[model samples]
Target: MAPVTNGRVLFNAIPEDYPVPGKTVVYDTTETIDFENVPLNGGILIKVLLLSLDPYMRGRLRAPEIESYMPAFPLGEPLTGGGIGVVLRSENDAVKAGTHVRGWLAHQQYYIAPNLSMLEVIDRDSKLDWSVYIGAAGMPGETAFAGWREYSEAKKGEVAFITTGAGPVGSMVIQIAKQDGVKVIASAGSEEKVKFMREIGADVVFNYKTTDVREVLKKEGPIDIYWDNVGGDTLDAAMEFAAKHSRFIECGQISGYNQGYQPMKNPGLIFAKCMHFHGFLLAVLRPKHSAAFQAEVVPKLVSGEYKFTEDISHGLDKVGDVLLAIQKGTNKGKAIVRVADE
Candidate 1:
C-alpha cells in the first residue's frame, strides 16, 4: 500500500436569500494508513466514483436547528450523502479491495472508513450499471418502494398520481405502479417532462405549470393514490381530486424549499376525502424495512422490471451547480455527480 492524497468539497452554511447560491470549497488532505498498520476495526480506503445530488441534500445544507431526520452538515467538514465507490485497500474481509460499494459518507475523492456498517457491498455479478446503485438500485429506488409500500399500501387497478413525475423517484413510482396494474396520472413542470413521463409508462401526464392540475386530474378520473413530491399548490390540488380513502405519500416538499415556508391552504380536502396522508424518510426505512426492500425491490431493478433515468453532471467541481439546478427543477432525472469512473 502507498500513501495517497484526497480532495473533497465542504459545505459551510445555508443561504439566507432566495436563489442564493450555496457555498462549497474544495481542499486537499493526505491519508496515513498502510496494510501493515491498518487498525483491526478499520475499513480500508475507497475512491468515490459517483455521488447522488438529491433534494434532501438541500435540507442538510441548512443549520442543525432546522431538525430534520438527517442532521445538517457541519461547517468546515466535507458534506456527506449517498454515493458509489470502489474499495482500494481494505483490512476488513467483509469489504474486500476492488469491490464496488454504495454507502452514506462525506462527499470526497476518497474516504477512509473504520469498518463503517453503513457501507454495503454491491454485487459485482449484477448486470446493472454502477450509476444505478446511486440511482434506481440505491437510495432513491428504496425510497420510492418504502414510501409506496409502507405508506400508500397501493393496490392494483387503482389510480396513482405523482407530482414531479419527471424526477428520478417520481418516475420510478409511476413505472412501479403501472407494472403492478395501477393506472398512473402524473404532473411535471414542463411539456418535455410530461412527454418523458409518458415514455416511462405514466398512464396520463400533465404539465402542472401550464395546465390546471384539478382539471387534468378530474378528466383522468379518480386518484386512488397521490405521491406528493412537490408541495404547496400541487399538493393542495392533489388533495382536492383524491378519491375517498385515497392514500397520499408525502415524500418531499421541493416546491417550498426555496421560498422558505408557505402555509397549507387546503386542510378541508383531507377531511372530506378521508385520505391517508403520510410523510416518509428513507433513513428511517433503512432500519425498519431494509431487508424486505432488498429482497423484494432489488430483484425487480436487477430483472429490468423497473427502469430509471439518470440526470448526471460531470466532475466534482460542478456539484454546487448541479445542486442548484436540481433545486430549480432543471435536471430531468436523478441528479448525480460523476466523481470518477469505475
Candidate 2:
C-alpha cells in the first residue's frame, strides 16, 4: 500500500475587511490525509465529489478568537461547508460504502467525518443530479424553503419582493413563492440574471444595478412580504415600501458578508407600519425542513417542474477562485466545485 495524500484548501489568514485569494485562502497540493486512521466511533470516510459554495460560508472565515452562530474556520486548517460525496468506508451502520451523502465535509478530496450525526445519506431513488444535493436540492433549497415557510408566511395572492433574486437561495425563494400563488417582484444584479428571474416565474424582474430599486418597488409593490438576501441599501429601500402589517424575512445580507455586518438605517419601518421582521439563517431550519424537502421538493426537482441553476467549476485548485467569484456575484445561481465526476 502507498501513502496517500489529499489536496485541500486551507483557511490561511482572517481578513481585515475583505478576503484576498492568496492571503486568505491557501491551496495545498499534498496535504497528508491518512486513510488508515479512520473514524473511531460511528463515523464515515467521505470521498467528496461536489462541493457547494454559499455566501454563509464567508461569515465562517473570521478569526478563531471570535464566536458566532457558526464556528469560524481555523487558520491553517481545511475549510468546511455543505458538499456532496460518496462514502468509501464507514463505522456507522446508517451509512455504507457507496452511499451518496451530503454534509459539512471539508475542502478536500477525502475526509473522515467523525460525526455521522452531521452527515446525511442521499435518497437513492430521488433521481436528482449529484450537484443538486449541494445546490438547489440541498442547503440553498432548504434555506429558501425554510425562510418562506417560517418567516415570510405570506398568503396566496400577496405581492412578494425578494432581493438578490438571481442567486441560489433567492431564486428558489422566487419559485417557491410563485408556487404558493404569490406575485413576486425580484431584484438581480445583471440583465442576464434579471431574465433568469423572469424565466423562473418572477412576475417582475428588475436589474437593481441599473434601476432605482426603491422607485421600482414603489411602482410595482406595496409589498406584502419581503425576502431580503443582500441587505445594505436595498433593505433600506424595501423598508420604505413595505406594506402595513407586512412580513420581512431577513434571510441573508451578502453585501455585508465581506464588509462585516452593517446597520439598517430605516429599521423604524418595523414600528411605524406595525410590520414583522425576522432575522433568519438556514442552519437550524435545515433539520426541520430536511424531511419535507426530500418528500415535497425533491420530486418537483426531479420532474423538472422546478428548475435550478449552478455554476460549477472543476477541481480542488479552483476552490478559492470559485468562492471569491461567488462573493463577487460573478457566478450565477449556486456556485459549486466539481471535485470529481460521478
Candidate 3:
C-alpha cells in the first residue's frame, strides 16, 4: 500500500470574468485520508488516477442561480467531476479496496469520498484502455449514444450534422451515425479538426472559422439531424440549413461559455422549420438507459466498433492549464489530467 500523507485539493475559488493570467487554481491540504470515521457512513477512500476536464465544469464555477443543471462550486472547497481511480480503502461491501472505479471525484491526488452512488467498477480485462472509461466508453460515449437515440431518433440513410466534430463525443457520434448508414456533415474550428473529422467517417467536414457554414450545409443538402456542440453562431447557421421536421440535439454550448453568456440570435429559425430542439444532459439518461448502454455499447467498444481519442496531460498540477487549453480549443479530443501513474 502507498504511504498516506496530507492530500492536496485544488479549487478555483473565484470565478474569472475573463481570461486571467497565471495560476488561477487554489490548493489546500486535508488532515485525514480516511472518511470511514466521518458522519457519512459506508464511504470509500480513493487514490485518483485520472480526472476529466470538460466544458460543463466551466458552468459549475459560476453562480448556482445562473444554471439549473448543477450547483456552483462553493468557496474554500475542492471541485468535483468525472474521474477514474482505485479504491485505497472501503467501508462498503459493494466497493472493495484495490478495485478500479470511475465517478465524480475532487480535483486532488487523494480524497475520502463519502457517497459515490454514481461510481462503477471498471472491468480490468476489457481489452480496452482504462482512460477510455473517462472518454469514449464512459460519459462522453454514453452521451453520444443517448443523445442520438433520444433527440435525433436517427434513421438509416439520414443526414446528420455534428458541431465540434473532432472532439471525443462528436467523433464518436459521427462514427456511430455512419455505421447506421447516416451521412455525416461535421464542423470544426480549425482545418486540422475538419480533416480529422473526415478521417473519422464524416461524409462532409468544414472548418466553421474558415469556410462558410451555411454554404457548406447548402451543398450537403437538407440535414435530418444536427448534433450541436459548439453553439452560438454555428448553431444559428446550422438552423438555416435544417430540413423540415429535423431534430436538433443541443449537446453543448461551448461557443458562449467564454463570453459568460450570449443571447440566441436565431430562435425564430427553429419555429419556422418546425425543427425539434432537444437539450440533453447525460446524467438524465443514466437512470433509464445505463444497463442498455453498457450491454450494447460496451461490448462493441471491445471489438473496436466504436473509437475514441484523448488529449492526455501529465500530472495533477497542470489541471488548470489543461482546462484553459480545452476552453481555448487547443487540446485535441477529450482533455484528461493524469493525476497518478497506473
Clash pairs detected, candidate 2: none
Model 1 ranges with Cα > 4 A deviation:
1-5, 17-41, 287-305
| lDDT (Cα, tens digit) per residue for candidate 2, span 12-101 | 988776677777888897666666664456678888999888777888889767888788998899999888898888888888888888
Against the hidden reference, what TM-scores do the models get?
Answer: 0.89, 0.94, 0.91
RMSD (Å) of each candidate, 1 decimal: 2.8, 1.8, 2.6
Q: Give the higher-TM-score candidate: 1 or 3.
A: 3
State residue 140's C-alpha deviation in candidate 2, in Å: 0.6
**What lDDT score belongs to each candidate, Candidate 1 first?**
0.79, 0.84, 0.79
Per-candidate clashes come to: 1, 0, 0
TM-score of 2: 0.94
Highest-lDDT candidate:
2
Q: Which is better, 1 or 2, measured by lDDT?
A: 2
Model 3, C-alpha of 106: deviation from truth (Å):
1.0
Model 3 C-alpha lDDT per residue in residues 11-77, reported as the tens digit of each score: 5555565323234565455444443443335788788999988887777666556756788777556
